[model samples]
Target chain A: MEPELATPFRERAGRALDDRFLQEALTVATTKFITLRREAFAELPEGDALRDQARAIKEATLQRLDYWLERLIERIESRGGHVHYATSADEARRVVLDIARRTGARMAVKSKSMATEEIHLNDALQAAGVTPVETDLGEYIIQLAHERPSHIIAPAIHKTKGQVAELFARELGRETEPDPEVLTRIARAELRQKFLDADLGISGANFAVAETGTVVLVTNEGNGRMVTSLPRVHVAVMGVEKVIPSMTDLAVFLAILAKSATGQKLSVYTSLVNGPRRGGEPEGPEELHLVLLDNGRVRQIAGPLREALNCLRCGACLNVCPVYRQIGGHAYGYTYPGPIGILLTAMLNGPAAVKDLAHASSLCGACMDACPVRIDIPKMLIELRREVDQQGIAPWPERAVFGAFAWLLQRPRLYRLSARLGRLLQRPFVRGGRIRWLPGLFGEWTRTRDLPAVARRTFHERWAALEREARR
Target chain B: MTTKAEFFDRIRAEMARTPGRAPSALAARPVRPREGLDVLRRELSERWRENLDRFQHELERVGGVLHRVAEAGEVPDVVAQIAAERGMHRVVTWPRDTLGVDVAAPLVTRGFDAAVMPGTEVAAAERARLRGLAAAADLGVTGAEVAIAETGTLVVVSGAGRPRSTSLLPACHVAVFERDVLVESLVQMGLVLEAWHEGAEPSWRGAAINFITGPSRTADIELTLTRGVHGPKEVHAVFVERGLSVARRA
Candidate 1:
């Protein structure tokens, strides 16, 4: 588990709300992303249809996932590449470390891959005597400060340029102005040398094609190219669910992925790597390794979170989520953040891990609309909440209160009798038609929010009076 | 470590648990991709003019400069003009037979340090030296294998003479192409991809393929869009109207 989870979720959210800079940055970044995504879809007439097709393709691939995976493995092995199967995150880390040891790799350069982050690979690499370098501009900044990413695509969205400048000064001992251009130039120079010198390149595959034995990576920065091309050994870590059937299916996904992520028709670079370098190629990795990580995804095949396997990791849901727009990603306290992040967290960790996070959403359904494949995140979140309640993961007092409310709701005669008794008993607490505070354990509910006072006459009583007047 | 058999067994067991699923199908692939590609090339030949116009507009929208030449020989002039404007001297390029134009000799005559990659394998030391030159060069020149008008993307397949870094590692990249390589949209590009992988790969072809839409850019820090983060800062496409003189190899 992440160390940040030690703090209660309420305190973490309270801290995020109190941070003035975080609030401003979250508002600006998410609002801009939302507008860009809207305009991008508006320009394409067949955007909605393409989204549906992408979703169907994902579902079709899942139905026969084992067959596709077998074919993918066969193709990769045919091309002189190695494939590793890791059932858990620990096993995944061990597979990569063993590769690093066999290759005698001293330093490793990485592109932006959330899979690596999900497994906490950097700490493992460090423990194994391999230095890992992050090449993406945002990833580099957060790595310098030893902080986790706050946003998926824009990893450094929570940071201001001034803070970035300070980080560089303190970490790298290089002082510069707080400008994105200058900062980017600094990172390019620093990472360029690492790319050439590093023995291994690690990355995450956006989609792996089973028909052609291809692993595809999409990035706006050219680091993906450098990582795959310059290193002597290339290692790509991908979840089993990321595989698709054919190159034709890849086209459908490529059409809508970037448009939803950053509103670009296509990112700057979409690299398709087929195993290791072939003969006569001037430059490419001599050795290629692909790690297929299950990491709790296999169980979801028959579980309630089956629809979430279709996620493209485009992060459009994050931009449009009302809860995400307010508190930002750090409050989620997991590798992934926002609406889909909650479901993915519950998938990776069980429902008990998201006992509080399942209620993070307002059930607004904006995430559903913004999702490229439309994963129905709110529906899954509701299901997770039910599971949490049924599993007894929620606190006992909260469950007891809900249980009592359910009983009262079922018995209308007892409910009305209790209401009349409470109306007479609540004379001391009633003020201005609002119950501001309760004396006992019920005060927990009204402490943060107000409850409306019961009416002088209940709805049933009012209906009876109207009927009598009509009869008269 | 989990063995392959165990992984497959786990997956199969889970898959068996869910007996019913919604009926769905993948996109229909062309039965004869190579023949389909030939037919597509013939159809695109008729609409080359309109496709070129759309390509220019989209390319420019994505921050790329497009230059038109009546003949392949004039491509060097555009490359020279771009270099002169930037005051760049070091240039790296793909081989003449693969790129369809001989820009190195002309650029060398114009007082630029031009390096052309060989069409065959070289020693490891020579390879490293060549890579150093690419990393230090100021401009890179190559040919686009497929140019898509819909998204203004250039598909470059790495091969013997066509090193991937020739278009990367440099601040400015200039690609020379003709009408024969133009496609209308990503769907057509998909068909082209299917055709390329249909049979045994050509001997000269390598393992990596890239679809570059524009110059490398990032908006990671404070959401400010900055170009030239890692790849080329400037991208220029030179179009030959009379078609390339070299015979098509693919």
Candidate 2:
């Protein structure tokens, strides 16, 4: 784990809240995304049914994952492409490194891929004496700043343009105005040379067609096209669940993916690459490799979080999530962020990894509504909470308090007695008729939020008094 | 480090351990994709004018330029006008046989440094030099294999004479297509994709199929939209009303 994660999620979230620029950026970015997504979906009359169809397709694919994967491997190999299976993140890293070593790759141009981030591939590449350059504008900015992406679609959403201008001056040694146009042009000129010089290109597959052995990459900036087309060798890192049944299924996904992510009818470039360069083709990579990454995804096929495999990584849920809107992606302390990110973190790590994270959601169900595939994130989060509790991963104080509350609930006489006692016991802590602060471990809850004071008169007592008055 | 056998074994075991959440089925694939596509094309032929109008509307909405021409020979005039407006001269294009028009010769005649890609594989050094030429060129011209109206996307396939960079590396991209290539929605494009892959792939076909919706764009900096980041800054679609005399590749 990185050192930042060691500070604990609370401190990280506090830090994010204190940063005025980040707060403003998060609000502006998320609100704009929400509006755009709503407008995009509102225009499509069939959007609702398409969401269901997309979900059904994902479920159907997972049901026969082995068949599809085997067929995909056969198709790619027949077209002279290599498919490697990795059971873990470490294994996936080694597989990529081995390929790089054999191909004599000194530098790799990368398109924005969450899969590569999930496996932490860049550091490994750097350690092996191979430079990995991020080509996506947002990703490139974050890479130079030595920061993880704050938002999935807009990785540099947390950075202000002024900050970016400063970053460029400091890192690239090129000073320019804080204009997006100028900054983008500068990046284009710098990365264009890398694309031409790099021997290897790496990308993530948005969807891989088992029918045609095609790896699909969607990007608004067209970096996906450059990384796949310009290099001598192209390697695509993909989660095992990314494969769809055929080209027909691909259309269903493409219809909603961009609208859900960035509100574009379609991203500027959607590259459907089938293996490598064919015999008579004038341009394309001579060698193509597809890394089928398991990395904790395979276990979820039949496990509790199986529905999460349906995620398209569109980042819609992130924009709509209340917790995410406030604290942003970094506070999540993981590769993914927002509502879906929590589930993904738990999926990649174990249930223990999300002990506090599981309680992060407000159970508003906005994420499910925003989700293109409707993965039921909140339901799975509740399940994870149960798992955490059962495994004794949650703090003992929390477990004991909840246990005592449950016991008291079953006994009405004791419950009523405790309520009367609690009202009197809470007098000192109660301010403005709310529990603003509490002492000891109980202060943890009150520090960030307030709790309503126990009603002065119990509901049962009020009911009895009302009945007596009615009889009189 | 896990072998393919071990991977399959693990997946198969997981599958046997539990049934899926619910009974589900995949979206129905076209049974006879080639026949379906032909039927779609015939149906579209009568209503192509409406489709083209929609394509123009959507294309412009997404920051692309649409030019309508009476014949294939008129394409170069549009290309020249665009170049003149932008003050751009150097042009790289797909070969005449592949692009279905002779734009290079006319472009050169009009004082543009136009270079047409070779129709067959070239040696490594020559290929590298051609790539450099593409990288430095101001304009790229290619033929659209499928023009989707719903999203204003021009699908271009890279093959023997058609390199992917022709549509990618240049600052501006212009694609020529006929009414027959226009489809109303992504669903129809899916059928076309299935049809293209239904039979054995053509010998000339490369490994890539690109859906170019508009000029490249990004909103990474403070969510400010910027165009032509890495790909073309301008994307122009030239529609030839009278079909090209040369046949399109399968």
In order of appearance, the predictions have TM-scores of 0.97, 0.98
Q: TM-score of predicted model 1?
A: 0.97
Question: Could you give candidate 1's per-residue lDDT for residues B1-250 as a string of tens digits?
Answer: 8999999999999999975796567888899999999999999999998998888898888898889999988988998889999999999998888888898999999899999987788888898998999999999998888899998888888878889999889999998888988999988888998999999988888899999898999998899999999899888988898857543455
lDDT of 2 by residue, A290-322 (tens): 999998888888899999999999999999999
Top lDDT prediction, candidate number: 2
> Which structure among the candidates has the greatest DockQ?
2
Cα deviation in Å at residue B7, candidate 2?
0.7
Question: Model 2 residue B235 lDDT?
Answer: 98
Error of 2 at A313 (Å): 0.3
Which residues of candidate 2, in runs, are more than 4 Å off?
A428-433, A457-472
Q: Report chain B TM per candidate.
A: 0.97, 0.97
Give the least accurate 10-residue stretch of model 1 chain A, judged by summed lDDT.
A442-451
Quality of candidate 1 docking, DockQ: 0.81
DockQ for the candidates, in order = 0.81, 0.86
